[model samples]
Target: MKGFTSYAIKNLKSTGSIARSSKFLARNLAKQVPTDAKTIVELGAGDGIITRELLKYMPQQAHLTSYEISEELLALLQRIDHPRFSLKHSSAMDIVQDFAIDSVDCLVSCLPLALFPLEMKHELLTHIRSVLKPNGLFLQYQYWLSDKQLIKEYFPHLKTNWVPLNLPPSFVYTGTAPNSELVAE
Candidate 1:
């Protein structure tokens, strides 16, 4: 079983701490992030796959900060050493407390939300809300739809889109502040 897991990890390009996300899903999530955003934060930045795409799409003047729980992936990112990118070797849940309140223009997460316990999810979402700018967006992609209610409860004004091109398909949930609403059908 260990050998099989290792084989799967090698082929899937996934570390034990991160999920293997499809390129299609990454593109869709990238589109949701505003290119003009000044300060962007990425949660669960595994292997820097989405990080590479974000740097490609984000404006040159923008600053991109990423958090990765895995020391291996964090070390790997440091080796690439992009000037516009800053990586934190920490858990996504600690982002709000680590950074100043309302300092982030956007929050993009590729976290495996379904794996987290309910209390942890709620706490993270609360922290995310506290740190985000009033007009900022919080984008999260998940493989399952079971957590839709949990998302809606935390982010009352939320917009959801499905990207079927992903390996296992995925849902992108974009959350906005109370007074804002996305014009998605």
Candidate 2:
């Protein structure tokens, strides 16, 4: 977490933020997780800041699997030793290969979708839809509201919350999955 700025600077395309998420931003996102949730997935878990916050608010029985592509960040995430917590050193795109379809109760993402190309974003959103149960929760944060229309294609019941406490501020998007399943394109 100490070197977040440098890591983000070096890996802007993936890391996406120069600062570790503030507690305010983390809390805002965590509050949306269902209290009865059993399985939770975190995408692009850089620095494990948000991951830690989720652990605090989640039900004790809930298991959290955090995915990170950066080896260095994965090493940082490995420092967490909760029995309900696990880490995957893989891309979010490979989520279907790692978890069963319609198996997850909720998903919290910091994947920097705005930085990704439209097609790739579509694939990621599709994977998110594929893994979540009907009306499952999908939470993501961005510096802008640019992806709302795109995400609407996947999650029909989408809502946005503003967290100005974060550096440069952040917009948290909460989406409820449609009943229909999604296939990777």
Best by TM-score: 2
lDDT of 2 by residue, 1-185 (tens): 45888888887777778778998999898888999999999999888889999999998789999999988888899999998898999899889998898999999998889989988898889889989999889999999989998888888778998999998699998999888765224
lDDT of 1 by residue, 64-179 (tens): 89998766566656765688888888888788677787778889987778877888888888788777877788899877787888888767777888988765678899987544
> C-alpha displacement of 65 in model 1, angstroms?
0.6
Error of 2 at 155 (Å): 0.7
Structural similarity to truth (TM-score) of each candidate: 0.84, 0.95
How many clashes does each candidate structure show, in the order listed? Answer: 0, 0
lDDT of each: 0.75, 0.88
User: RMSD of model 1, in Å?
Assistant: 5.1
Stretches > 4 Å off in candidate 1: 1-19, 179-185
TM-score of 1: 0.84
Model 1 whole-model lDDT (C-alpha atoms) = 0.75
